[model samples]
Target: MSHIKDVTGGTPIVLESLWKTYANFVAVSGIDLSVGAGRFCTVLGPSGSGKTTTLMMIAGFVAPTRGRILVSGRDIAALPPQKRNLGVVFQNYALFPHLTVFDNVAFPLIMRRVPQAEIAQRVERMLETVELAGLGGRYPRELSGGQQQRVALARALVFEPRVLLMDEPLGALDKKLRSSLQIELKALQRRLDVTVIYVTHDQEEALTMADQIVVMQGGRIEQNGTPEDLYDRPATAFVAGFMGDTNLVRGVVMAADKDGTLRIDHPTGRRIIARASGFQAGDHVAASLRPECLSIESPDGPEEPENAWDGRIAAVTYLGDAIRYHVAVGENRPTLAETLVVKAARRGTEHRRFSEGDAVRVRWSRSDARVLPPTRADARILPPMQAGGH
Candidate 1:
C-alpha cells in the first residue's frame, strides 16, 4: 500500500467557466472550481441543482456547451469518457447482473488489453482491499446491499484511475450501513491518496465525508470550502439555511452601531442587536440563529446580555441526548412560523425540563445571531482559473 502511494495517486482538477445549457434552460452556469490533488471534494445540492450535470461533464460522459475541463495541467475537455482516465461510481452501483464479481472487477484491465495473469493478480488484491476477498465468484444478487456496494468499489479501483467521481454512491444503503461506509470509504481514500469528487444531496454525508464541500444551487456554486469553514463561517444566507437546522427571522435595520453592530426591528415588534456590518439604517435583513445557540429559561430565572424574547413553548421534542423546544413569539401570535427553537442538553438530573405550554424566554449571544448580508449578483464567481492554468 505504501509503495502504491508513491507510484500511484491523484491529479489536480480544474474547471474553468464550465457551462452547460440547452436552449432556454441552463443546466450548469459558468462556474470556476479548483480541486487539488488527493482531496475529497463533495458537490452537494438538492436534485436538479446541477451537481450531477457538473460531475457528468467532468467525467466526459456529457459534452459541455462551453468552457474547459483540465486534468492536472492539461485540458481534457474534448476527450471521450473512456479516454479521461477517471473512474465513476454511479448511484445504483451499476454492476453487471450476469457477470461474476471477479469478472466485473477485471473489466477495466481486460478492456485495456492487460495480460490475463496481471488482471487476475490485480482483481484478487482489490477484492481483499474492499473486504470482499473470498466472494469474487458471487453474483451481484447473491450479496447483500453493502456487499454489492463494496464489489462496485472494488471494480472501480482495480485499475487505479487518477480521480474517482462518485454520484451518490452510498445513497442506496440504509442509515447504519451508510454511516459505516462513509468511514470506510474515507479510510480507503486516505490509503490510496485518490482525489474524489462526490455528489450528494445528503448534507450529513457531505459534512462527514468531504475535505471540501461545494454547495450548489440553481445551476451555480453557492459556496465551496472546508467543512468547518462552511459550517461556522458561511458567506451566504442560503448556505446557512441549507447547511443545517436554523431559525431565520426577517427584520429591517433600525440603527447601525460604530463597532460593527446593527439594531434590527423585528416583526414581533422587538429589537434584535446583532454583531454585523455593511448595512444602512433602513436596509432589510434576516438574522440566522442555530437551534443550539439559543437558551431557554423562565422569564425571571436569569438575566443575560444581548437580547431576550419572552415567549411560550409551542412544541417539545425529546431527543435522546438533547431536548428541543419550539417557542412562540408572544401571546398575540401563539403559533407563528417564525417561532424560535431552542435545544438544551439533557444531563441526567442537572437538566431542567419544560412543558409545551410553559412560559419561556429565548436569548442568544450577540455574536451567535448573524445578520445576513445582502445577496449579491453572480459577481461572486471566481475569475477564470486558467489562462491556460499553470
Candidate 2:
C-alpha cells in the first residue's frame, strides 16, 4: 500500500510437531503452531525459550530434528532458505557495507538472474516506498540506524516473498525510535497484507504489534491467543506473570458460593472471593490481581469494595502516567512478598493523590481478581535476557 507495490499478497503457515535438539539439550519441543494468511503473529518468551530457534527452523537456517513445516498447505521441509521464498529482517540490519543502498536492495534480484532493466525499476520503486528515494547511492555505513533498518526491510521485500519473518528487527534502536517503527512496520504489513511470524523476548513489543501471541517457556507452548485473551484470562501462573504486572496470591479454595463466586483462604488468612468456574472446595489456587485493577478506596467513596486490605505504603515508583505503590499488608510477613502493588493514574483529579508512607486502604472488586492453578510462592517475573538471543 501507499507507494509499496503488493505482490501475490500472502500465504498461510503451519508447524506440525516441530522439534529441535542439539547434542545435550532440546531447543524446541514438539510444538504445533498455525498462522493464517496475511496475519501478524509473534512468538514471545524469555531467554532460552526457543522462539528464535523456531523462527530459524521455519527460515531453514536451522533444520528441525523431526517435524514438518507447511507453507500454503505444501510441505517445505526439504526446501533451502532461498527456495522457501520468504522475507527475513534481522536485528543487526545485515546490509553489505561495500555496496550502495540500491545495489544492496538489488542483491536478491541479481541472484535470481532478473534482467538489469527490471532490477533498476524495482529497486527505485522499493526505495521510494521505504522513504529512501534519494539515498540510493549512499553506503550502509553512512546511514543512520533507522535508515539501515529500512534498507534491510526494502531488500527483504523487494522480491515479493510469500511470507515475512522478522527476528527482533527493531531491538537495536532506542526506545522512542523503536516505538515509532513498531507502528510503522505494523501499518506496512497491514497495507501489504503479508503473513508475518515475528520472534521477540519483549512482552510489550509483542502486545503492541501482534494479532496473535504464542507464549513459550522451556521449549513448550504455554498459551496462544489474542492479546486481550492472554491478558484477561491467562490459563497459567507463568502466563499471568509474563504478560504484565500481576500480584499472584497463592491460597486454598475454601468453598464455592452461588454463581461462580469462589471463596479462598490466603496463606496468611486473608480471605478472597473471585468469580471463577471448574474449581471445587479445597483446591489450592493462586489469585491474580493486576496493578491497574487496584485503587485506594477514597473516603468520599463508593460503597465498600468487595476486597479490601489495610496496609502502609512500603515503596513508591513514579511512572510518567501512573504511580505504583508497594503496600505491605499488616497481617502478612514482609519477607513473603505479601506486599501488594497498586497503580493509580495521575488524572489531576478532584479526589486526591495517595502518597508514600500513607496508611491507606487498598481495594479491588471480586471480578478484578482471577483464580489460577497453584504455582510456586516465589516465582519472579521473567527478567529480560540481554546477552543471548532467545
What tens-digit string does per-residue lDDT give for candidate 1 at 1-390?
011122244688888878887766777888789888889999987678888889999988888877878887678976888898888888774799999999999999999999999999999998987778999898989999778887888887777887999988887788987887789889888887888999988988889889999999878898999998888877777888889988878789988988988889887688789887778899977788889999887888665555898888888998888999999885586545459888888887655478978888898889998788644454323333355532
Q: Name the lDDT value of residue 315 in candidate 1.
A: 87
lDDT of 2 by residue, 1-390 (tens): 012223355788888878787764778877888888888999888788888889999999998877778888778888999899899997764799999999999999999999999999999998987779999999999999888988998999888776999988877677887787788778878888789999887889999999999998888888899999899989888899999999988888999976888989877777887889999899988899999999875344554545887777888888878888888874647744588988888787433366667778788898899899864333223323256322
Q: At residue 292, give the lDDT of candidate 1.
A: 92
Go through the candidates in order and give the clash count of each. Answer: 0, 0
What overall lDDT goes with each candidate model? 0.83, 0.83
User: Against the true structure, what is every candidate's RMSD?
Assistant: 4.6, 6.7
Error of 1 at 252 (Å): 1.1
Q: After superposition, how far is residue 100 of candidate 1 from its true place, in Å?
A: 1.5
**Regions of model 2 farther than 4 Å from truth:** 1-9, 129-131, 143-146, 298-306, 330-332, 349-352, 375-390
